[model samples]
Target: MTQATHRPASWSVVATVRASAPVCNLFARHYLARGARQVFLFHDDASVACNVALHGVRNTVCQGRWWRRGRPDALEDRQVHNATKAKAWCETDWLLHCDVDELIWSAQDVGEVLGLIPDDVGGIVINTAEAVYAAPPSQHTMFRTPFFKFFFDERGRPRAYRAISQQAYGDLWNASKYGLWGHILGKSFIRAKADVGRMPLHHKKQERINGFLMRQQAPQLVLRHYDTLSPEMWKEKHLRRIRSEVSVPMAGRFRERQQALIAEAEARDGNAGLDQLYLRMSTLPPGILAECLTEGFVRVIRPEAHLLAQDHS
Candidate 1:
């Protein structure tokens, strides 16, 4: 663990990537537009050549493992190393370690919300929400709409809730034993000067680092994880993860779920059955999103108020 000796003025976004160019570029654009000084992106060598080639902002790039190597933990370890390496190259006072789809939004400017974080704090533990769209975003997506954001108490403890379609699917599509798939809770922001080692997917190990972990009492900074935001994007993402193993710790269990899904698909009519499964997973959610809101799954929040896609209504 290393303690940061200096704090700079600008902030940066450090991301470990395995996503497409457009997705990666979009991620970089979102942060840069929000005042990120630089983006430190890490990807495998296969993508190294063209990575960050599309970003129009100040940015840096690093490389992760090119092979699927050992357990999913090994890949996570590699990503942690990449994040650490990116931090070394970063000159900013604070950096956000996030993924392409996970947009960290704030009603106030992100930097301003980040300012609420104390100088002595190591980082803030933020909660995540799987923003389910009424349909594909037509205009301003994230900024224009209120989502099924995570419910966090004043102390930052998460209130997990299943989606509206919770009863639509069986155990295969159910939330994992570990936690709800989209309502994940974890760290999003970290102090640059802290002596820390990256661990557990989105967060790093802060034991040796100085200061206590602070929680943002207000919903100023909520991570909008767009795992199912668009049909094409969702299909591509889940298909890739289904065809290959992911670095998430619960991947083995996930794989079992996938296998069960595959068995059911085959039982029904092979590829057609899988197609049926995908259709159900994607299509049934809009009704549920509405029902949940009406029935009060997560109350419509202020600033974080409701705004569905215009065309959907």
Candidate 2:
């Protein structure tokens, strides 16, 4: 058995989460174990169970405190509000804003990696390795998936992911700005108290924002994003998206594309049709998964080894 190496630094993480108690606890545990100074989880839905579950965790802050007058209507608005407030409250050298489903993966301690960044660097972009499954696993077991793909982009273009997605979906696929199903531009760790105009849905990118400088991409760290794990989860997710009135800003055709897919699936065979579409898009076939692994389109990662002291534990 191997133990995580700790290089201590003042760094904290913040997220606006709505998840089960166990899920919330795991998020706190993983980051705390990975050497974050503290983990602030602002409950979007204010689940009492989740707050209670985190009680025993040292350096974990669980709260349902609304940022200001009341909760915002849009989910993205709530996220940005929570992240901004957490930044003000955090007494750390750096603060990371990411989702609960996204875990920081690094061979060296996270703080040690951040320590090397120069004072002039305002933030650092952590590249993402989106999780890919061979088969749909239960949501509880999704994080343990051994396969992940790091989409290669040349000058902000996802040529590699586009090629692979085209092979999978054929005529069904369309050219997307991002490589992955999730946010193509990964999350970031900003210097605490850095002057920023506003927080975007993800992070401020040089291409998208002016005067927001980011350091060269960190080599040792990658965000392991479990975008969708099971067909049931996928179905529930898209159904909510379709029904919701508040949509993401500048989302391009992504929202429209999802709504269309769900509608088509329902017309075909209701839930079963939706499940089939999800399976096809979310998980790779055995042959393609194997080929992607061999051809360097994707790579295998065992984060459990670092998080739990055992692979797939």
- Which candidate has the top score in lDDT? 2
Off by over 4 Å in 1: 1-9, 45-49, 53-73, 136-146, 149-173, 176-180, 204-208, 212-218, 229-236, 239-259, 266-271, 283-287, 298-313
The C-alpha RMSD in Å for every predicted model, in order, reads 6.1, 5.4
Residue-level error in angstroms, candidate 1, position 269: 3.8
What local distance difference test score does each model get? 0.54, 0.69
- CA shift at 119, candidate 2, in angstroms? 0.7
TM-score of each: 0.71, 0.83
Per-residue lDDT of 95-183 in model 1, one digit per residue for the tens? Answer: 77777667666666777666655566666666665554444542235334455534443455444344433543445454332223443
What tens digits encode model 2's per-residue C-alpha lDDT throughout 1-313?
Answer: 1222333557888887766675667788788777787688877664333662343233223333444466567778877777777778778888888988899888887888887775556677888888888888775677778788767643444456657656655655662233356766778888776776555456675632234455446768889988775667667666766777444554557657766877888888998888777776668889888777776667888856544433222
TM-score of 2: 0.83
Residue-pair clashes per prediction, in order, are 2, 0
